[model samples]
Target chain A: MKNPIDNLNKVFDSRIRLGVMSVLLVNEEINFNDLKDLLQLTDGNLASHLSHLEENGFIKVRKGFIGRKTNTTYSITKAGEKAFKDHLAGLENMIKSIK
Target chain B: MRSKEESLDALQDIRKMMERSSRFISLSGWSGISAGICALLGAWFGYGVLARTGGESVSASSRTSQVGLSSMGEIQQLLLIGRLTFAAAAVSAFIFTYIRSKKNAIPMWGLTAKRLLINTMVPMIVGGLVILRMMQTGYYDLVGSCSLVFYGLALVNASKYTLNEIRYLGYAELALGLIDLWQRGYGLLFWALGFGVLHIIYGTMMWWKYERVQSK
Candidate 1:
């Protein structure tokens, strides 16, 4: 078997990106405020990480207006879902094989 | 290159973050609120049962001796009511909890939830036994206090597996049970306060914290 490390995606190496992917994979969509609260991260840090995931085509971002205020939401793209699952499976295999 | 331990830790962290719940608690707030309502209703029915049976001591004496149709099988009736109330509460709470878990796409009976259930059930099963024994020996006065204390212990023990909010509720239950122990003849009152009122208050807070707040 090929090394599982070789199958892992580098994007998920960062804890924040991994967290965002994990949440989006489970939830249909999560708004910016709730996501921020869940992760307990500042707006700037979360935004940068969110943008990084968006750039990799691993997540979809949507901006809309909820009444007067602008609402930003995020969800995992199809590619993201597959990539994340693969990364997680790879990590599991890596742990089992390495251990 | 990370070691095996670090990789495993990351996997665990991913699961925790994915839950959309507090680090420990997988149980939802809606369950708490509904359970409280059921408890209140049960207490009301229980109180009505006692009032109709000429109260506890009178019913106890009637149980031993031959009496008219007044006190016939009061304990059995009360026990049946208790069982039904427990069943209703459990079913309703399960429904609400299942809905929340489904919306979150979290498996209801996953390993973490199983651990929570096991931690909660241990003290509860033991308490059920103690309660049954008390009823068999006719130490009826201590029944309410025992139930409260045991339930509190169960909640506290399971707090490590669930939300920390349960710990405070457990403490409240312990305090109420002790007071009931000190002053007997008010089991139903204490039961109502502990399980009914306290559950509603705490459940609302939990719902607000986890559900309403999150929806925003």
Candidate 2:
């Protein structure tokens, strides 16, 4: 099995990165730590994935301060949204073909 | 500020967020506006029907017009104004949401027509019948609450196809209905809560969480 997630497979293949993108796709903006908790990834792992996505123009990273601690938030870009939606559509088509 | 690998990693994280949240975009402003219009119009027609008759005690089958200065008359007049006010607020809110959607360049009525019809018809038809029943019985007092309750039910039932916030809106209406059922005389407060205040609150939330946030 080539994995139906093949063509749909993200250009960035790490499960952690895919997971992070998936979360940002839905929420308008999510903080770094909240993403950390949701994905159960280490601080280093999450940060690496975020950097990748932001570089790809798939997401936008905003930095600000909440109280004293610096807050970093992530949101999906149009290209990112398109990629995700196409992936789902591809998966659905694959499922239909299997049936 | 970061190495090539670090930059790649950040972009990947952003992509992952986009993927996860894509399925649940915020409701089109038009949807809220359309719903508001439907609600206002429904309220108008429902309240008007009641005005032609009288109180909950009045027989539904009777066509007798009750326009005198009796208690029913006073109540009817108050409710008439309330319904009009509700219609105005909803219409204005609808306009506000619609204009915002257009301004943001979100596709208006991009929804498939068939789904839109089914979603619009179910609650509306059911609500229409309910309103008619209320009118016949002259449950004019219950008219305001009934509108809110039925409208909420519509939103809850049809929420699968559209905005999830609508379901919350329905729950709010149901709450208002229960409050109204508990106290029969305070129609104005319930109207304000259900039609006026609730819309503003829900609209603001929708705008804040989905609209004003300006997702990249």
TM-score (C-alpha, index-matched) for candidate 1: 0.62
Cα lDDT tens digits, model 1, A36-98, are 766778999999999999999999999999999999999999999999989888888888897
- Residues B1-216, candidate 1: write the lDDT tens digits: 977887898899898887543333546787877888888898888778777866763223324344436644766777787788789889988998888777776656654566688889999999999999987777777877888999999989888767778899999999999888887557778887888888888888888887886667
Report clash pairs, candidate 1: none
Query: Which stretches of model 2 miss by more than 4 angstroms?
Result: A1-99, B1-83, B112-117
Please tell me which predicted candidate would have the highest TM-score against the true structure. 1
Taking chain A by itself, what TM-score does each prediction score? 0.95, 0.82
Q: Candidate 2, residues B26-122: lDDT per residue as tens digits? A: 3444445444544545445554555565535322122224434564555565456655655665566556555654564443343322344477578
lDDT measured at residue B33 in model 1 versus the true structure, 0 to 100: 77
**Model 1: what TM-score for its first chain?**
0.95
Q: Point out the worst 10-residue segment of candidate 2 chain B by lDDT.
A: B55-64
